[model samples]
Target: MTTNEHINSGEWPLWEIFIRSRQGLDHKHVGSLHAVDAQMAIENARDVYTRRMEGVSIWVVESKHIHASNPADAEAFYDPANDKAYRHPTFYNLPDELKHM
Candidate 1:
């Protein structure tokens, strides 16, 4: 398969895709598959993952390139802060007439 054209055509590595079904919600990891290029990856992800209800947007990243932190560093990775009130906008009273965030 090394020197063959057929195998060479399928050389592009696999990728994992994430999809955002709607606004205001975090992107969720959908699944993974192979493609010849990035554009094909997106199209393939749509045909494979979202053939039914579908999503608003899609993201495709090479599965081999994803770097994740060790789970053993959980405490140091995501620690809660005591004075993070400013990070949240809950105290501000937004207009009730507004339809979207």
Candidate 2:
């Protein structure tokens, strides 16, 4: 089948996999793969990314479900958030217990 035909067949959907090695760590994007469903995607991710048993957990997200900003709009999209100083804790007077943070 042609690439377009295969893609439009709907039998395979691209999934982005995130893996967390341990409990305290956050899940990081490992790679993408094609799968028929969520369960298949998870299985494929485990096989592809955790061959050495490195990951304790896996999250498979359909690529289409992810909404991301365009790199071209980076400045316009992220500049506002950067100027919000109150979002940072630097303005707060922390107690001795929390000051170490």
lDDT of 2 by residue, 1-101 (tens): 44346468855778999999975479998889988778988999988999997799999998888998899998998888986989987787878886448
Computed on alpha carbons, the lDDT of every model, listed in order, comes to 0.78, 0.85
Q: Write the per-residue lDDT of candidate 1 for residues 56-93, one digit (tens) a residue.
A: 78899977689999998887766755457777877788
Candidate 1 global Cα RMSD: 5.7
The candidate 1 region of ten consecutive residues with least summed lDDT is 1-10
Worst 10 residues of 2 by lDDT: 1-10
Clashing pairs in 2: none
Compared with the true structure, model 1 gives a TM-score of 0.57
